[model samples]
Target: MMKVFDEYRALSDDTLKPDQPKAKRFIEAMRKFLDKKENWTFWLPYILTLELCVKCGTCGEACPVYTASGRKEIYHPVYRSEMLRRIWKRYFTLSGKIFRGLAGAKDVTEDDINALAEAVWRCTVCRRCAMVCPLAIDNGLITREIRKIFDAIGIAPDELKENGTRAQIQYGNATKTPTEAFKDTLEFIKEDIEDMKGVSVEIPVDKKGVDYLVINNAGDYIAFMETVMGIVEIMNYVNADWTLNTPDTGVNDVVNYGLFYSDAELVAVAKAQLETIRKLKPKVVVIGECGHAYDSFILYKKLYKEMYGEEMPFKLTHIVALIDRWIREGKLKVDKNKNPEPVTFHDSCKWGRCAGVYEEPRRVLKAVCKDFREMYPNREMNYCCGGGSGFAIMFKDEFLKFRMETYGRIKAEQIKATGASVVATMCANCKGQFREIIKYFNLPVRYAGVSELVANALVYK
Candidate 1:
């Protein structure tokens, strides 16, 4: 058996060779694209905007990988951005060519390719850096463009290549689980809900005329089945006319990991969900506890509009916000006594930071948990769990350890200080990562999704 270090080493070494035909083509394409002086119109805005960056290193301090890696030179935010900046300078600025050394312009050699590949791909694109940056430079967008440049040359990381291809070819979702399996997973959740809550929840799959269609990430179906059950329970309890589209139901393919650049591929994924909504002619679309799903839908709404020639017909809502609305409207009632433990909430990167969804989850938690305490840097400033952007599946051991040692360290300490026995988060990804980190640290705190807590606290009369 290959050791863990050996496995990662082998995977890292799989980067395309400089002399490879595909690599040559990619470099040529990138060179041509960059060389187009007219293209400077598009590039200048970002460069000019970035020039205002004060380099206060606030973003550097906010990065989970940088913190976990002990602020290594290669993991620094400026280091990766500088790599792209140097290349941009060489191609776009005349001074860079005449005084390349002074301008920090360096040729994109094989080592640079490998280093760029490794460095950019390591980020979860959690946007914690952008949240802290004074200029809001959006390093995540920079990383995405870098991935696009690398992908044009067929040099994406193995995990990205495998997952992206699977999403495109298999179930049309990144998890690659078949539609039948997805249906079965829903059936299993229905059964579990029946057993746990004595409620028969009907999760409509592709049911037409529903008011809303909920899109769930496959990870929630498989590992966090309770969350799926909780969603169904709540929808059923409130008599909300919602359906799950099992046929191409897995639509959370933000694949922001940088493997896909074609707008066509992204639209294809977005359209699958929209098609379901269109067929059902739902009044709105409610994206479930998954943050990236909302980001894919709301933040990148233009992709769908460009593809289909109009905006998504229905409104889009994050599940937490929907729950909060329902609670405030008296559509749902919860008994906080069931969740008497003191609790704290972890803000999900996609929900809290990227999408600016801060208070909804807290509202849901405050209603469900008797005692709720805030993490030190809560909301948009919360640390990433280090296992996002497909890192949970790709870099299992290292990412999990990183979560425990860094992101979860402060969270765990906060939970301990609060004397809370549970930690709740609205995002399925955060719930998944926290479960692992809490178990690894043997912390007495239990982790639950805000929906799960609400489901348990339902006061049905």
Candidate 2:
């Protein structure tokens, strides 16, 4: 029965505690990160967002963070959004320069930045707030900008910057999963596919001149190998000229944790993935069931134009889209009877809000599952899994408890209300989040990829 404000205040001890000796350094770095002239010149969207927000309270009701925290006033979207907007006005506005006090401007401190930094992490950057706002103020974008400012000051979670962005940029993937591991996993998947459907097909790798080059999170090879097998089965059934790169090739996975932490790191990691695509020269890049990866590739196209002065060398398509295309073409057939159990879909924030992909995964699910229940307030209006940012991976004890108890609890209740034995999602992060919730809360539900459900219903040719 702890209030959300109290729960968040507890996080302040750890998350908002600035290094007192380096307070000046943090302030300086924060300003530099927000510097309009050099580091970040694209400020018009941010400007419109800041000037546009009217604080009408529509966004508060729309936000999952606010609702999920049992209507916590701290998680209210306007709280952090207004803080950044005021900070911008205080330093960057002409009105503030002439009449600071009249303009409601104040000199912000290191402590202020620390509190805002923690607030940024509290949000999942789900963009639900903007969807309902009359002014189209994206608090999610504002939250990310705050995170970038923190990242510049060396104040972000180490899991995202170190274990995720740096690890992937320096060595290819977050785990640096071995080439042999990829090969071995594919071999096992092929055998499993044969055993299940009496079908056998070669898993393509490092092959040149294919129509598509697909990549997934390396975690798939470790735990959800069935999803990988699903992909291979559908690819074979569609007669796709697709390939998976060797792990040594440094682009086998398509995740960029930098999307959560900073723009610079997102650009660097995405450029690396694009380089591999350039080498392979595929017509399109298929990003497998990871929501952020779809978003990263979309961002990459813009970054590529800015850096290289041209459109990207390849195309990027979500795996859900690819499957939907095949189904529409009558190329990959599925039997709905294969999955008779009740099912529900969780629309990932990146898929619906970030990427405008609402129907593809749902269409596939409907075609494959007999009893597909819709989560209320679904599609672009759907709630977050509470693991959208690094919360799923960054597990400091207090943060873990907050994510489970405060943020993830609402989604659990939604699933339980449906009485669904299985909840399916396209994003690995969503699935991973729910997997933990299933065990920790001892819920009757389990998680599955949308692809896995389709694979279950696949009628092999």
lDDT of each: 0.67, 0.78
Predicted candidate 2 versus true structure: per-residue lDDT over 316-430, tens digit per residue: 7977899998988888888999999999999899888989998898899999999999987689888888878867775664676677776578788888888888898988888
Per-residue lDDT of candidate 1, residues 178-221 (tens digit) = 77887787788888888877888888887766786776666677
Residue pairs of candidate 2 with colliding backbone atoms: none
lDDT of 1 at 182: 75
Best candidate according to lDDT:
2
Q: Model 1 segments beyond 4 Å from truth?
A: 1-12, 15-46, 49-56, 248-265, 396-411, 414-417
RMSD (Å) of each candidate, 1 decimal: 3.7, 3.0
CA error at residue 196 for candidate 2, angstroms: 3.5
Error of 1 at 432 (Å): 2.8
* Candidate 2 positional error at 242, Å: 1.3
